[model samples]
Target: MDQQRHTQKKLDNGNIHTSPKISTHLDIEVHGAQVYSHKVLEEFQEEVKYSIDTCKIRGFSEAGSLEVTTVRDANRDRNYQVTYCQDTFKATCSCRMLERKGIICRHVIWIYSSNGVKKIPELYVVNRWCKDEIRMKMFDYNGEATEDVDIIDGKQIAMSVMWSEIHKTVAMLMGKLKADVDNFSSVIREFKEKLSLYGSPMNKQQQLKKIFGCSASQDITILPPKQ
Candidate 1:
């Protein structure tokens, strides 16, 4: 009876109430913080802090557009090779942190800092870790749109795409203006002016409806599964 009661109590509380607290610390702010979830941001910031504090640039060699940098980690007493392309802002580290865990490693962050790159490249920003809701379209074998399209809110999908494009454009421009303080200030000023022209923002309920594609009067209920 005690065991049954304990199990029943756990079921009533659900996962959120039962899960342990996750304590995270943000050391420094980065562009990833805007897009990525809190957990992902925490891990990425740790790498950034590690690169800044413990990693050292041993040397770098150039081959065409590719530059291979040797970064030594004081804590680990290990060397990592980071190959960076100046033309494309593409970087690959021998540690392969991105490949293994979908987080940029300290070695690559050290190289980026040395090269005056302020923004994390969009390529390194994993979509799975991002806070944005990504909707996937399904296609039939005949290349026709599946019934799933009818269920998803087209407006929400369109807004998501438009926001994604705007984000990419802003990220690209920010990277270009990393060293140009005058241009950067002008861009920020222009953006603020443009935003003011949009007038007052939507209320919380209206904003939620737009994002979730649900009417205020819509009923949300869970039904028992079919036997």
Candidate 2:
């Protein structure tokens, strides 16, 4: 149903509409205020370290049921007790800027200009979440490249692809990628055997780098610093 509506919208406007997305998340302060308001126009809900501005202007909340945490008071210089999302988030501050005017308070406005973003450091790797980790092979096969195609509902959907939805469709293409890998595994094994027989000059670290292109980080689990 959602997909149908999205398609219909695109057809009516003859344009692809971008979905609202939140900015990077910031850390929760141990003891301080947090705000998250920017100019309105229904951008994305950004989680940040301090109070913020409201982006919704017209009829935002019936009984002001709109519960977004980005509102702050300016004159009294405090925060608002905005509640949204079924108590997942709550704000309690003694700010007055938000009390009288039903407009976006100074608290929410502060976060807007803070140039702040959410601080979730570890990003979600689509490959990690999908069961297609080794499908890294999909990226390259012995340095050979291939093209990506779109398929939908057992039929090839021409030029219709969802960028992030790649993970969702993995179940369908997993078999094909795996088959190609299985068929090529022997070639990889044969190459390794030849290299071993010929006596390679590279060390273990070098080989690791060749396989996974990243410098290894410290393994705290294996070796804790001497206390």
* TM per prediction: 0.49, 0.17
Top candidate when judged by lDDT against the true structure: 1
lDDT of candidate 2 over 84-153, digit per residue (tens) = 3222222222354334432233344343334232321122112222111232222232233333322223
TM-score of predicted structure 1: 0.49
- The CA lDDT of each predicted structure is 0.73, 0.36
Model 2 weakest 10-residue run by lDDT: 29-38
TM-score of 2: 0.17
Residue-level lDDT of model 1, residues 1-91, one tens digit each, is: 5596577445434422433233333222446666666656678877878887899989889999999998899989999899999999999
Q: Which regions in candidate 2 have their CA more than 4 angstroms from the true location?
A: 1-138, 149-210, 213-227
Highest-TM-score candidate = 1
Clashing pairs in 1: none
